[model samples]
Target chain A: DTAVSQTPKYLVTQMGNDKSIKCEQNLGHDTMYWYKQDSKKFLKIMFSYNNKELIINETVPNRFSPKSPDKAHLNLHINSLELGDSAVYFCASSQEASGRTDTQYFGPGTRLTVL
Target chain B: AQSVAQPEDQVNVAEGNPLTVKCTYSVSGNPYLFWYVQYPNRGLQFLLKYITGDNLVKGSYGFEAEFNKSQTSFHLKKPSALVSDSALYFCAAKTGANNLFFGTGTRLTVIP
Candidate 1:
């Protein structure tokens, strides 16, 4: 079974359009995270949620918002997408809030392209 | 603040030869270091981690990492590399606040 999964493997939209990417995990983990990989292959954390509670919010723009309906799901919504938003977004989950010793499993990743 | 660094942008090795990918880190307190590998068009995959125990930790696909406190380094190593092992490797360190900081990444090319 796929431990972590993401929907809309590829999203291509025009500028000013809105889009959303869905993420889910069946590893029975408590914490989920959203990460963005830019053109340079730099991976940065965008948001983190623990038990449906927002925990970490990086200095990302307000145009990007993450919502967690439950512990197993965390979705990212982009408002008025721009060309800069084109990149691969990854979903990950870990077993503990400490995250120090836990292994975070990642999904296949969703490639977002804003033209 | 916590951060991880991968000095080498790329490392090339021949099949059946040993390989090493260097990684260094800095944090306020004890660090929880991890190694992840990514293939083309795929997400990152967990390889191994070091919390607190033996300095050497082993993980999937014959990959292992050594954690050195004094040097503040966690380097990934393989005794014999396979052509299939060619991929991008990432090193990360976790802070007290549970934030994970990732290095830029090192591309490993195992030539046949």
Candidate 2:
């Protein structure tokens, strides 16, 4: 079974459109995170949720929002997508909190294209 | 604040040869350093991590990383290169906070 899985492996949409990416993990990890990999291949943390509580919110645009209904799922919703939003988004989860020793498991990633 | 740096943008190696991907970091307090690999069109796969106790840590696919506290460096190395090993490698650090910082990433190309 896949540890972490995201739906819609590929997404293509036009500007001003809204989209949502779904993620789920079976590893029983407490913290789930969303990362954006831009065209330059730089992965930056967007949001992190631990047990449905918002932990970290980086300097991301308001168009992006994350919702975790439960510990096993974290979904990303992007509103009014822009051309610059074309990139790959990944979902990851880790076991613990407050430290760096926790190893994160990542999903297959969803490639988003704003045309 | 925690940060990671990947000095090389790309590393090319021939199959059966050894390869190294350099990574360094800056963080407050002890660091939990990690190496991850990403194949094209895929997300990242955790390779190995250093959480103290020892200087070297080994992970899947025969990849290993050495963590140096004085130099604040964690480099990924492998004894033999394979075409399948060609992928993007990322180095990251976890500070005292829950957030993890990632380097830009180094692209590895293993020629057969």
Candidate 3:
């Protein structure tokens, strides 16, 4: 069984376009996170949700919003996508109590290209 | 703020040669270090971690990392390199709030 999964492996769109990347996990985890890896290969945490509750929101812009409808899903939506927003986004999940701690299982990333 | 550093952007090694990728971190209180590997067009895979006890931690694919508290360094090392090992490696640290900060990845190219 796949622990974590994300939709739309590759996305290419023009500027000013709005898009959404969906993520899901079947590991029965409580904590889910989103990370962005830029072209320079610098990966940074963007958001983390614990049991459908927002826990950490980094210095991400207001244009980017993360929605967690439930414990097993975390979706990222970006408005007015700019060239600078082009990067690979990853979704990960971890168990909170005994199933998860400091260790997170990642999903196959979704690459977004803003032209 | 907690941070992790990978000094080398890329490292090259022969197939049979030993390889080392250096990483350092800064965090308050005890630190939890982790290493992950990412191949082309793939998500990162967790390799190993250091939470408590045993400075030397072994991970998948015959990979191991040594944690040096004095230097705040956690260097990944392998006795021998394989051509299939070519990938980008990231070093991450959990310093505070149980948050993970990843280093600028190090690309390892094992030449045949």
Candidate 4:
């Protein structure tokens, strides 16, 4: 059983196009997160949702929006994708939202290529 | 503010030799540190964490880390490295808000 999973493993789109990546976790976790890994392999958190409520919103651009329909799912939608958006997106989940000690599990990741 | 640093960009080791990947952290309050490993084309995998227990923490795949409060470091170590252990390693610090700050990853190459 995959604890965390992300759909559309690879996304290739033209500049200014819009795309969405889906994430789901069966770990029964209360918190979900989205992270971006740049070409240099620098990982940074973008957004987090706890029980379908926005909790952590980093200094990300407004073009990127995260939506959580339910506690088990979190999706990221990128509008006007630019070349800078070409990177890997990871989805993660934790057992609780308030526990700083809780371990997070990550999904396979979606590789986005904005041409 | 919370931050993690991995000084080494890459470390090469031979099979059967011990390996160490250094990590340091800076945070406001008590530091909650974590180690994650990533293979090519894969997501980050949890290796270990230091909350408030023993300074020496053991983790998956024969890995361990020592947490030093004075030094503000959590360095991952392995007694004997295997070629399969070659991968990218990351150190992270969790903040009071449950946000994680990751360091620039260190690539470990375990040569056969």
- Worst lDDT run of 10 residues, candidate 4 chain A, spans A50-59
Highest lDDT model number: 4
DockQ, all models: 0.73, 0.82, 0.56, 0.82
Arranged by TM-score with the best first, the candidates are 4, 1, 2, 3
Which pairs clash in the backbone of model 4?
none
Error of 2 at A22 (Å): 0.3
lDDT of candidate 1 over A1-115, digit per residue (tens): 9999999999999999988999999998999899999988899998888964676565899999988888889999999999999999999999976656778889999999988
User: Which residue pairs in candidate 3 collide?
Assistant: A95-A100
lDDT of 4 by residue, A1-115 (tens): 9999999999999999999999999999999999999999999999888864686565798999988888899999999999999999999999886887999999999999999
TM per candidate: 0.97, 0.96, 0.95, 0.97
lDDT of 2 by residue, A1-115 (tens): 9999999999999999999999999999999999999999999999888863686565899999998888899999999999999999999998866546788899999999999
Model 3 lDDT per residue over B1-112, tens place: 7789999999999999999999999888888899999999999999999887999999999999999999999999999999999999999987545657799999999999
Could you tell me the C-alpha RMSD of candidate 2 in Å? 1.2
Off by over 4 Å in 2: none
Q: Pick the candidate with the highest TM-score.
A: 4
The C-alpha lDDT values of all candidates are 0.91, 0.92, 0.90, 0.93
Which CAPRI level is candidate 4?
high
Per residue, candidate 1 scores C-alpha lDDT tens digits across B29-88 of: 888899999999999999998888999999999999999999999999999999999999
